[model samples]
Target: MMTSRRDFLASAALLAAGLAVGPPLLAAPPKKYLGVQLYTVREAMEKDPAGTLARLASIGYNAVEGATYTGSQKFYGLTPSEFAALLKQNGLLMPSSHYRLGEEPTNGAPTLGTLLHGWDRAVDDAAAVGAKYMVCAYLAPAERGTLDHYKYVADQLNRAGERCQQAGLQLCYHNHDFEFVPQAGQRPFDLLLATDEKLVQLELDLYWATKAGQDPVALFRQHPGRFPLWHVKDMAKTPERAFTEVGNGVIDFKKIFAQAKQAGLHYFFVEQDTTPGSPFDSLTQSLAYIKKNLV
Candidate 1:
């Protein structure tokens, strides 16, 4: 089976070319899409909800997490139908929304007569907007301050989560630095996670988690697949804890993003609670950087 010189050289050249190009061809990287939390542009949203959404879409945001609906139902304003239409017109998808869990006493609890009247309406509106998640973005004063209080809050979250689940939506809790405070030897954040793995999930705010002196990677390691959403914001190097554009600050997003699979991340929204410049400019820059580097 000895080959001639010409045939042997040709076969060797073909084999070398295939080996050089095969690895890249076989390894197709995953696509990383970007989204925005509307709350980041609260001021602009207040002025014109539709216009603000349009601007966000134009800036390369394909998905949006609603802060409020500013239309007819006044379920913050935009009725589910109207809001859905608005998003459709602008080529955006509404995958999640922030809603205050358990109304304030002044606003009346779910047991109150006025509140009872609209339970179905709330569920209907959420469905209409195509929101898969309804996040409890904050806690009431009575709900915080101690370990016992957080445990109680966690129970309420479980109950609410059951309701959300019935409506084909998942319930999530968004964190701020306060949740990181330790109480009676256990972190409130840990207590919340321990509440009910099935009933409660986390939407980790990377900036706040870092600000609270906790490592985001450690939390991810401690509870794999518990975090479904992430607020990808950067923290300034200053002592005041200022909000900086994504790539301009000290947070290492690339490292955090690498754990997306273990964290069960479904969406990562860019949120700068207070941008050094205009919120729009800040988010635009953040998105550009994420696309260029983190993705």
Candidate 2:
């Protein structure tokens, strides 16, 4: 088909202005979508969600995963659509969110229907913000006490996952080092793994697995495709083993990233829980390292 005069002139203007490369047939540019979990700059997000996202975009991050959504099912106090608009304005997208179940409801524990309804609403809001995954970010200490507890939660997660699937979303659990620790001679993580694989996917936090002395590669080998997301953080050399910016610590990220396909890594996010200086600077350093070595 012949191009119209207006289209041709527009194309010419874009090329002349250096705003676009050329016609799509000549070459198609790759889209770079580097991911960051917003919890890395929790303070900044709390202060100004919009500004923090703008800063992230300036740092070359195009994707974000939220780690905070509590009480009213809002993202940093803004409605889902409001937050989505802010993210769009800053050239960013949120693909995942950490929504907690919250301390297992004290007043005689809400009915299953009530829980699922809440999850449905959460899923709807998350979808409104263009998120694909609604992850159970953390489990409370009081909620987990024995093997039966893990089994029960697994069942709950399966039902929850079914509900999430109904809304065209995936449900997952993010783990910390505590899951590796034995409880009643069986690790809670193991119970989670034993759950219906299709129902409860895992989002592995690399630093915590390493800190707890578990090999991520081996886990991948054991359960391929179970882990689709990763929290890519590094552990410091301190005794407390605090989180540090990637590539400046003891973890072997290059080697781990080499096994990403084997580990079923669909998406990964840079998350440094303890940035000693400016979080933006730390994120920049981490992204630079990832671009040079891991990605």
Candidate 3:
């Protein structure tokens, strides 16, 4: 009935402390739901894309990045509509696709008319499958030799990105170790970043970036809000630097993820290029680690 001013002040102080710390103590970090690149399970997928997708869904994958359209589209085999229906039936979402840049038929190769023709079909199929990104997964061998070559690649990427913009999708470049090599006194990757930040966003493969002797965190700092996605795989302690599941290697994901907002991260996919055992086992272990440590 009678409360002293001193007691009220003490209670208020305690309340403030609890308000400041209680939520963090009780609540876990937000869940980073796991995604798998279909490429990791290429063997299984090649055998049965539909069946493999069903199994992946059952294994708790909510999203997928497409590696090929092997259903009925004749691009692979599946029509765009058929591919979309298959994914929908299996409770999966395709958010991105990896396409080769200069390998399309239209550039006067053997079979197809131009590389861009296949790319156009890819964009149409990706749109049909509701993908948000069209990714240039790798550069051609000819395109990889020089800085001038990379600049040309960047130019091509800008053009592709314009098409992607018209299709309401973003074009992204997935890095490998080669891009880190110095060219024209700068890393080709850096040139690409500078060439067109809007036209070519990044899907930084943490493992490859580290293998290339670059710091992922520094890149994030240098290009704040440019990376939209990340490949959250790990590297082994060996000289060959084999692929390992997430959190099993030395990369500090906790530190990298601390700048999630600055990195413009929308989603991160767990990709083990070569698994030591079953792909499912590797992915499950990786996802479990993320759930426990970095989520």
- The candidate that wins on TM-score is 2
- Backbone clash tally for model 3? 15
Summarize candidate 1's per-residue lDDT along 1-295 as a digit string, tens digits: 0001000000000111223544643434443447787778777876788888899888888887766531233433666787788989998877777665444443343422111234445556777789887676766555487788777778777877777778888878888887888777788888889767677798888888899998888899989989888888888888887888898889998898888778878887887777767888998998888878876
Off by over 4 Å in 3: 1-33, 69-76, 103-115
- Overall lDDT per candidate, in order of appearance: 0.71, 0.75, 0.70
Mark the regions of model 2 whose C-alpha exceeds 4 Å error after superposition.
1-30, 105-117
Candidates in order, TM-scores: namely 0.83, 0.85, 0.83
Best by lDDT: 2
Q: Which of 1 and 2 is the better model by lDDT?
A: 2
Clashing pairs in 2: none
Return the lDDT, model 2, position 108.
Answer: 62
Residues 212-278 of candidate 3 have per-residue lDDT tens digits of 9988889989899888878888888777788888888888889987887788887677778778889
lDDT of 2 at 215: 94
